[model samples]
Target: FIRLMAKPEKLGDLREPRAYLTTIANGLVSDHWRRQSVEQTYLDALTLYPTEHQPSEEQRALPIELLLQLNTLLQQMKPLIRSTFLLSQLDGLTYRQIADQLHVSERTVKSYMAQAMLHCLRLKNQTDN
Candidate 1:
């Protein structure tokens, strides 16, 4: 109704008010479409912005062969123990934090970490040949 009033297309004299309303509505629709197109163009130019810790396929396999060998060697341990080791040793999370995240006691977390380290030592001995 307001759009029709603002952009009335025709004068009176029994001159089809419906035509004027249709004209205003058409113009408003066109304007709305144009705004959407322009907004889309602007957004397209904007960057998604990179993340600090982006995970990718190549990242799954590092060039550190020794680390890979050690990881493969430690595969015999329980999943929880391996995860604890990675989080605490590689990711640098504290034993307390690992315990909180894993719902285990700090002492147990420390023990798992120690076991992980010992596994790595064993791997080193096995690979030293």
Candidate 2:
């Protein structure tokens, strides 16, 4: 199990073999499930979208990849922050309108919008690498 669970170099330098192996295995398992959850959510969304509006084969892959990145970023955000961002961007609402709709102050809406933009820039940086 040690041989399978950890890299050879990790095993060679391990001060506590069992602890090291367990940590490595746990990380691997966590990453596996994270990727799986992202994939499942993307597939579920695609299914619910109107079939007539689906992208062509040549255009499909990039959007799907970008969508997964966007979804991951959005999932990490607060619910109100996500909603404020979407309403402002997708619905083309003004800050006052979002503040009114969300029953929050305009200052809070601006802060949420800033947080959302930072999240998007972080995702863009990740993709660039």
- Candidate with the greatest TM-score versus the true structure: 2
What lDDT score belongs to each candidate, Candidate 1 first?
0.70, 0.83
Residue pairs with backbone overlap in model 1 = none
Cα-based lDDT at residue 6, candidate 1: 65
Q: Residue 59 lDDT in model 2?
A: 67
Model 2 local distance difference test score: 0.83
Give per-residue CA lDDT, model 1, range 1-129, as digits (tens): 664456556233436778877887897887666556554544444335355444343653353334445545656678989999988878899999999999999999989988888887887787686
**Location of the lowest summed lDDT over 10 successive residues in candidate 1:** 60-69
* lDDT (10s digit) by residue, model 2, range 14-86: 6786787688899889767776777677667777879987666666677667766777787788999999999
Candidate 2 pairs with clashing backbones: none
Q: Superpose all Cα atoms of candidate 1 onto the true structure and report the RMSD in Å to 1 decimal.
A: 24.1
Candidate 2: worst 10 consecutive residues by lDDT?
Answer: 2-11
